[model samples]
Each structure stands twice: as C-alpha cells, then as structure tokens.
Target: MIIFFFLQSKIFIACVLMNLLIALCCFHFC
Candidate 1:
C-alpha cells in the first residue's frame, strides 16, 4: 500500500510538472 501510494504521488508530480512546462512554452510562443 505504501509503495502504491508513492508511485501515485510520483506520477502526480510528473503530471503537474508537465503541465507547468506546457504552460511556459505557450506563454513564450503565444
């Protein structure tokens, strides 16, 4: 259970970082 939660949190953080990167790219180009 703890291992599963850790993986989930890692995925969540990755998703957030991806979204932030996309937003930065849009702001720079558009």
Candidate 2:
C-alpha cells in the first residue's frame, strides 16, 4: 500500500513537471 502511494505520487509529480515545461515552452515561443 505504501509503495503504491509512492509510485502514484511520483507519477503525479512527473505529470506536473511535464505540464510546467510545456507551458513554459509555449510562453517563450508564442
């Protein structure tokens, strides 16, 4: 159970980072 929650949080963070990167790219390019 603890391991599953850890993995879920890791994935959530990765998704948030990806979104931030995309937004930054868009803001810089457009």
Candidate 3:
C-alpha cells in the first residue's frame, strides 16, 4: 500500500515537471 502511494506521487511529480518544462519552452519560443 505504501509503495503504491509512493509510485503514484512520483508519477504525479514527473508529470508536473514535464508540464512546467513544456510551458517554459513555449513561452521562450513564442
């Protein structure tokens, strides 16, 4: 149970980081 939650949080953090990176790239390019 704890391991499942840990993995979920890790995935969520990764997704947020990716989104922020994409936004930054768009802002810089446009």
| Clash count list over all predictions | 0, 0, 0
lDDT of 3 by residue, 1-30 (tens): 999999999999999999999999999999
Error of 1 at 1 (Å): 0.1
What is the Cα-based TM-score of model 3? 0.97
Cα lDDT listed for each candidate: 1.00, 1.00, 1.00
Model 3 steric clash total: 0
Tell me how far candidate 3 lies from the true structure as C-alpha RMSD in angstroms.
0.2
Alpha-carbon shift of residue 18 in model 2 (angstroms): 0.2
Model 2 vs truth, CA RMSD: 0.3
Q: lDDT of candidate 3 vs native?
A: 1.00
- Model 3: clashing residue pairs? none
- Please write out the lDDT profile of model 2 over residues 1-30, one tens digit for every residue: 999999999999999999999999999999
Model 2 pairs in collision: none
What lDDT does model 1 reach? 1.00
The candidate, 1 or 2, that scores higher on TM-score is: 2
